[model samples]
Target: MSTYQDADAWVAMADRTRRSIVERLAHRPMAVGELAADLPVSRPAVSQHLKVLKRAGLVCDRAEGTRRVYQLEPAGLAAMRDELDRFWLRALDGFKELVEDEGDPP
Candidate 1:
């Protein structure tokens, strides 16, 4: 298990290419070759993205023969999602209060 600061998770996912790779893995585990086939980047670029995701704790890998397969590290992603949800909840509550305050005195 690894701990990722909330802000960094957002940043790691900020890039469109990285997000696309992550989203595809969210569906199922895939070998690097398969990932490259589906992506616009070359295999080496995909490898580099995997390295970033690995360090961020958002992804993990295993070896099956010569292939290295990658998948979402659910535990890390769950933590990230929880943090995002909490942020949204707080923002929404503030929005609700602001909207209410703009109306006649409560």
Candidate 2:
């Protein structure tokens, strides 16, 4: 997918509650109840945030018996990381060029 579409991952994680949910899922897969237990939000609210995360491809869920378990989606996480790396690389390259230009005797 294009980086623009992948940008959705950033938008999805912009909310503090959603970020909290993502952080929790990073440690281990969790059911909605398990996730909500640690957060101030209600279970239904957590579920709503999960839906947004799922839509952004930042998370996936599977049925574990009677409950739905959620976990970070590697592909989506990797895409966001890769994009961040690219951004940093470009910034560094620009700085390097600026430094080199400044060092030239004129």
Candidate 3:
């Protein structure tokens, strides 16, 4: 079963800006200024999105000199992937049951 934190991660990623942030972080960890440069949003806006992502456990940050560099949280990403896998497995199971029932005589 998915926990509230897992649901929050999904909600956090529903935003386009947040998804873009995740995509960038997938390539490399980056500080706020670095992320803002590649994105259309302002640095502060990027920071705000980072906050949401962090709160959802989708990302983590570390202080490097004066800046905080952010990267994807592998455990959180794995949890989401596990949930998706469970969902697909359940759907396939149901489909198999339906097909087998159709093969039986009335």
Candidate 4:
């Protein structure tokens, strides 16, 4: 599969359930069953969320003996973080420009 964009990760995490799953995985890796057990969604639903996350490059899975374990993908998370940092830097620069303009004679 092609590498996913940071926007894809943002879209995938826009859902409450998916965000919850991400948060859960942030703490530790888990199987779909374990995720479903703690969440209100069904196992199949959790699996579906996993699929979206996987496609977005936010999560990856590996077979662990019998069950497939899912965990956060640091590269994907870093992409999102980098995007956020860039956005904040742009906003801050714009604010600084406005402040400087306010003090200018013209």
Candidate 1's TM-score reads 0.86
lDDT of 3: 0.96
Clashing pairs in model 1, backbone N/Cα/C closer than 3 A: none
Model 4 C-alpha lDDT per residue in residues 12-105, reported as the tens digit of each score: 9999999999999999999999999999999999999999999899999999999999999998888888888999999999999999999999
| Residue pairs clashing, model 2 | none
Query: Residue by residue across 13-92, what tens digits does model 3's lDDT show?
Result: 99999999999999999999999999999999999999999999999999999999999999999999999999999999
Query: Which lDDT value does model 3 have at 13?
Result: 95
Error (Å) of candidate 3 at residue 95 is: 1.2
Cα RMSD (angstroms) for every candidate in the order listed: 2.1, 1.1, 1.6, 1.9
Per-candidate TM equals 0.86, 0.94, 0.93, 0.91
Q: Which ten residues in a row have the lowest lDDT in candidate 4?
A: 1-10
Give the TM-score (vs. native) of candidate 2.
0.94
Note the residue pairs that clash in candidate 4. Answer: none
Over 1-106, each residue of candidate 1 has an lDDT whose tens digit, in order, gives 3344555667778888889999999889999889999999999999988888877778999999988999998877887888879889999999999998899675
**Which of candidates 1 and 4 is the stronger one according to TM-score?**
4
TM-score of 3: 0.93
